[model samples]
Target: MKKLTVLFIAFIMGFSGALKADEGMWLLPLISKLNMNKMNDMGLKLSAEDIYSVNNSSLKDAVVIFGGGCTGELISDQGLLLTNHHCGYGNIQALSSVEHNYLKDGFWAKSLKEELPAEGLSVTFLKRMDDVTQKVLEGIDADTEAEERKKLIGENITAIKEEASKDNDYTVSVKSYFEGNQYFLIIYEKYNDVRFVGAPPSSIGKFGFDTDNWMWPRHTGDFSMFRVYADKDGKPAAYSEDNVPLKPKHHLPVSLKGVEQEDFAMTIGFPGSTSRYLTSWGIEERMNVVNNARIIPRGLKQDLWKEDMLASEKVNIQYASKFSRSSNYWKNSIGMNRGLEKLKVVDSKKEIEKEFTAWVSASPERKEMYSDVLSTLEKAYADRGKDLKAQSYLIECMLRGTEIIALGTRTLKLEKALEDEESDEKVKEVADGIAASLDAFYKDYSVSTDRKVFSAMLELYYKEIAKEYYPSFYNDVVIKKYKGDFNKYGEVVFNKSVFTDQKKLEAFLADPSLKLLRKDPVFIAAKSTIKLYKELYGKVAEARASEAENNRLFLKGLMKMKSDKVFYPDANFTMRLSYGKVGNYEPKDAVIYKHYTTLAGVMEKYEPGNYEFEVPERLIELYDTKDYGQYAATDGSLRVCFTTDNDITGGNSGSPVINANGELFGLAFDGNWEAMSGDIAFETQLQKCINVDIRYVLFIIDKYAGASNLINEMTLVK
Candidate 1:
């Protein structure tokens, strides 16, 4: 702890003069020394220890990693957890049926017994974190080759993790910070018996859908509730009928005090990734190649799926999650490209690089280390550009775009097991695994829907990518035999392939044969595409590796050159804290935006039968009667959502937004559209985090849904 204290002091002394108040995703352990004073000035009443402490219960005890990618916070001692509705959308959809379409009508558990178990869902609590940098880089330095350096670091991380978890059930991992310049060991305890408690319907949860996904003045409820369960002994365990609600160490008291403009606000959660240190060449490649690849193909696929989904209610239920997932990113890519180009982010990076290069040339030692960093980046990106589009198409089309391909590839491992003549027991195990997976796989799968997707995406790939990069089967089969008629090709494959039908696949697996699998049309196409992708990937491996090393060195050099500028590491799905104020901004000239939206706005946007804007009958009744209960503001308006300047990204979805007294006031959900470029380069003026006002969450639960049982579970503060 003393060593960490020393490191914190050093970091603050280096950059304190230039650090902006609201710009960083800071490490929690350094808050007492580096940030407490400023936070106190901003109206924070709690000490740093109240927010984070390794040896006692604190705010960190309440925050949990939701599912695989989002964040959740415990709101009650009974382990009542709250997160964004979109974060729980997949589970809600999975549990839905045409008869009981929860996604459309919403759901609420009247009692603990009524809560439904979400299979395979889990929540994790971070126990503590320790700086392990010295141990991780013990024998590695400037002279070490990239390959060897990686190998040594991997070994060290494994050993450290093993040591940390020897006597506890904690899931431990060592993560690199600052591009491997620093490392920390994090420990987490995971609970697997999480259950779905309640959620508003998609109309409210996803009020704007794709249209208002990342926009401001949002009125979406955007929240869901779950409960964690533990074994009789109060320890982590798999699902069991005998399990009970967990008595957590800490849970946030919900605040009814609400928010005012410039009120102190903070968010704590796991952010997925950000490449803020990317050079100009990297930014160009991302904008042109990666973003374009995602936006174009996904949009095409979504259009076809949307038509099919709208035609039949059952089909809509089947494709709801898939369509939402695809369109979310498709819209994001489009927004990011627009933001980058409009904001001149590439020009900003170029100017930074120019300054860095100039600074490097002035010092011989720095020149030796960083002289080739920018050159390496430019050449690597240029080389990668040759095959980047081809690779994207392969992923979007063959691997992801076509459902039959994914289903077909699942049998490859069993085929390999048969080829190796594994034991009968092992063979049965593989067969059983495939059988279990098919139930969930085919539940939402539609042959006709996927057939259309395959045809459209395959044609797009064939027309857009070069022939030399095409998989062998494309040339030998589709182009050669079918005369490049992807429609006919899709028809034949869907009708003839065993992968399209669960019964057919099961029968084939019962009496498996390698020859049959190898001859299957879907499997053949998948194999060919994967094989070609591997070959192409091998070609760019060296250049990509060199680019990584050079980028790491460049970051190291830049930190020294700009010693007075605060530097936070790029996000890698790790927990971080960001603080700011609840403030509004002008996105463009003469356009002033407010800090919050109210229930009146939701009513204003309501269209009787429109999917994205439809309001539930009960919600309309409540609005018409002004029945907001205790959740309405001083002006007798129900606040729906608000904005904050806190830095956040993708995985921060569903994060808790706490006030100065460490009470839950809102849930962080989306970033404003004008600042989609925030991931690559922070836009101080335009970057704002949109949050669902916690009071709005309660209003819907108590008044609209009549779920007072949930209201009783939380500890509310005025």
Candidate 2:
């Protein structure tokens, strides 16, 4: 694995020892409710006063925390917003029917009146978070059962909500961290009125969907625009034609001054989660047991999906979206596992734990809990391994191509069931159930992209596993039905299977003659394979359980290692702030990255015919003309920057990259290839985050697209 050049020594020395007790202290100082001086010193150029003066008051107003899907920012007083294009792709797809494919052509509301309101879309702003560790874990002890512990925690959170709401109007949620070592009461204001404003074509936003995901040197413009809507009273309300654009309290200023090497930077958004505190045992299991058992099968599924995509257009339509998403995540796991192996993250964690355990041994009270924790974790891994395997199997087989067919059957069954049912409520329940499943079923099977992966995995399962497990379809089945040779069978069943035709299958299920084929040899073979796969999955679950228990022991040791000295939990898919300076990277002996990328480089990477690097003609023309005026390229090109030490994960997509002044400089998107494991472990040296220069965003908005009306609203700081 490549070593991180900047913070290698500091990270190696262990976070507790290498970092000051409050190295992240400069992040949130207590000088005042909104301290400008401290925030400036910490790397924000904007003062607390500036944040407040800019229509936003308090951290709550300035930092809007997107809930459920992903985090985004309110960029306009009239509630114009920005987020990852991938995040908004679903809505765009939903709006697009067969005749109007917005995803293919892109969607831009010519004016505010043309904006489309999407049902169920929401945006949440964090109003406040008070430390509630004591309140949450008041009576909890090491001996407490997991279920009892869960119940108590829930009750305490409910109580906290009741108390916090006495005079204030907000929603409260108790968040857990560091294995129950800490808790926070988060108060939020959720807005349900959000509309799709604009989006670039998927060809640009999702360029190189699988090819460039998790790999660096990326050129994806993964961004989209939305607007928050509110009633005349300025409070959140359900979507209605009468709703008006929202007036936000805070909106980030577009900074064209841009970032330079070693410049201080920070990302303030909700991070999904990480288990950097897991035990060496758990890490090893993830690296080996989990990855080996699940990731390979997933890759096989993806391959199958690709095959089907090429074979049938209908399959492409039904499964393409789902396969894209599934494969996108699958590749992350593949890279994460590979990177962990290269970085020896598991080994490093073990070494760190060795020192921690030794220190804990000095204290009698701490030593008493040590062995139990380790033993419990070991048992948990053995117990949980099967569950992990089961999940993988479920996603690959039962939930992919075949599952949707089953779903279509259920839908038809419900229609038939309702045809005879007299009770309106029961019929409604059945109809609703089918509708709910249909919504997911369409996305899940994504016939266009995912069928090949699903069917291929089924075939591989039959071929790879022990012969005893698939007796019926092992030797004679292949010989009689598929010519006995395993190689030919694999090619026919996986590489050339006709099941990839989603529309045909749907028709067959609808046709009585061919519908019975749904129960034919191929389907029966897959079903039997799934049954066995599920049993093995249970074994994997047991292993994961043991591993999780072990991780708890390891985390416990680290807590004692720090002993009363404060350190926040690693990450928990919750909002977190990581601060560091921008810097170049030496990925290898001969490869040195300058910590920035220019529009020229984007052009260099562009290949007109290649899907991975295709540049739009308009964007290329603008770049050639040097049309960027106020949003001029910072370094004489489209400025894409890199940073050395911000911890983020999947959900941090489209997070604003801000300077010490809190000025928006870029949008956080991809991480470097060497740092793929940073999703699980943040190595400051190897884990540099790649971002889209805010300048490029502005230039595209101004010169390329000619949306000056939108550009004029931003508080731009050139």
Candidate 3:
């Protein structure tokens, strides 16, 4: 493994080779050594240091991890941030009410005073990253036990973090790359005073909703704006009236020049997770077990939520964010399964494994290291198959599916604290914490809606999952007491559980009695479900430990075997850079996709009364008058969305699509449905990143919303 690392470094530094346009999520620091020449040749006008630099401000300074999952970019000196609307949906929903519904009507801060403070929302700037593989793996060798190696690695990582953050206000994490074949220490400075600046209404932001979520020829103006504020000393601080807008070290200049066919494009952001290194067996399990389990239950839940949402506007506002979050991945899973089968990814993985096996057999040393890797993975996945499925169902149905159960589970900690030390202050502290969370939880929660979803999910769990795998409480409470009636069980739980009523919960918390909590049906069910989940998680953990060790060896062996191939690490929500071009491809026979879509297409598809196709009156008036202002394309058409061959996944949402000159041109929000399988296997032909054109985002902000304050903050380039 050490030799392989040396060779890998040598390979990266020594080669002045051309890069393939269709693949690779390259590390930013390695850009100068490994990718600058290729990128320069492809049309990059900036130096590698211009992309990522430690000595000076660069593009890296402009990008941040938006909240927990998405990516955002600093587009103005005043910390004006740009991300996808969906990425900000939760905050938007949180701030929304029936009277002042931002989700439906949209929001634009006319001034800094109007910018709403978003509690608990944050943006983390990457301070720097260091290759810490040697430090992390110190005193570890081939003979070390997996558990011991992990402990050593954990200790080293902790020590490194402590040393790095001694006097600095930074959060540090050591992320393993290439399936633990390499490690990097990432440092981030997090700003907690994030504010909501602007967003288009859902009619435009989420135009097609579920129907066109992952599809191409997209026209959604899926962009949102936010701002980061800093304290008097220009440092991150909690929200305060005295805080000023952050003066960013580097902010992207927005380009209205627009993109063309094969125009050089790149996306810089934290892509969440990609399992491109998974074996054939892993892909099968993902498709049949994980994706299947999520898709079915979520689809059922969404259907129930949708019916309720459409029936009442208040319910619609309440459930909008939750339904969107659930349905987005549910649709993605459906598309991924289709793409996986259509692309024959499993067979392709099998072929690769055959090559890997053959390469290992060619040398005794390689055989000793990697001969058991494939077999170990096969057996581990095979042995854990039933449990894995059970775990998935358990999480989807019992934990994630039922709102009351999830809410009740929160009390377990309070119950434990009460049991251990019966102090009034401690009880009050726990009760207050629970009380603080209840408003937010119950804001979107509907008893009637959740009851229906609970019943449906429980019924599905009972019908689909094995009887033995059901939570013991289900058999004990539902079958034995309620006579196998899920509806009756749901009714009883909803009616009796304190979790169902905020007032009841508050009253109970005022008294602070563990006896009452232990007897609570919802709490009882939660305890049972959690216990079973932990037991199953333990089994899965054992399997994963063995699998991880074998996978590391396998990755190391594969790297040695295919030393010629440039191996990029699988995404783990760390910063990565992938460069490509604005181009399009055919999904199948006789169907060609263009590089971009225009507002004309949006109007063409517009049906005034239809929920998915409705266009805002102001937008329609702008289109009718051709009032595109300075944001229109050369053809006088306003480009709403475009396609790029850039590699992206879930967490890449709101990632800024940069041009050769490193100007922000688009916001990456989704992937083409035809290439949903790209996460597991990059389908160069069909895989395309769906991005909202920066011009359209500006058009909506400036023309439709008439929010000149936002336009004034941005650094626009023609």
Scored by lDDT, the top model is 3
Task: Name the 10 consecutive residues with the lowest summed lDDT in model 3.
Answer: 12-21
Question: What is the Cα-based TM-score of model 2?
Answer: 0.81
Candidate 3 lDDT over 111-186, as tens digits, reads: 9899999889999999899998888888887888888998999998999888988888789889999888688999
Ranking by lDDT: 3, 1, 2
lDDT at position 200, candidate 2: 72
The 10 consecutive residues of candidate 1 with the worst lDDT sum are 1-10
Where model 3 places Cα greater than 4 Å from the true spot, the runs are: 1-4, 12-19
After superposition, candidate 1 runs with Cα above 4 Å error: 1-9
TM-score of each: 0.98, 0.81, 0.98
Instruction: Kindly give the number of clashing pairs for every candidate.
Output: 0, 69, 0
Q: What is the C-alpha RMSD of each candidate to the true structure, in Å?
A: 1.8, 6.8, 1.4
Q: Local error of candidate 3 at 156, Å?
A: 1.6
lDDT for 214 in candidate 1 is: 90
Please report, in order, the local distance difference test score of every candidate based on alpha carbons. 0.89, 0.63, 0.90
For model 2, how does the per-residue alpha-carbon lDDT over 1-718 read when each residue is reduced to its tens digit? 0222122222322333344211231213212332333345656655544433223364336455543656787777888888877777767766665466666666777688878887667888776556676787767776777668768878988898799888866777787655655577877788998888887766667766777776556666677888898899889888888989888777777677877776777776676767666767677767765566556776766666667755754455455555666676677777788788888888787787677767767888777767566656656765665455445444454445344334433544444444565466665666555445445445435543433443455456455444444435555467577765555554454333334444444444343232354334445445444555567666765565445444555665665466544344665545555556777777778987777666676687777766557777887787788776766554455664444456677777777777766677877776667877875666656676777667766666667666777777778786
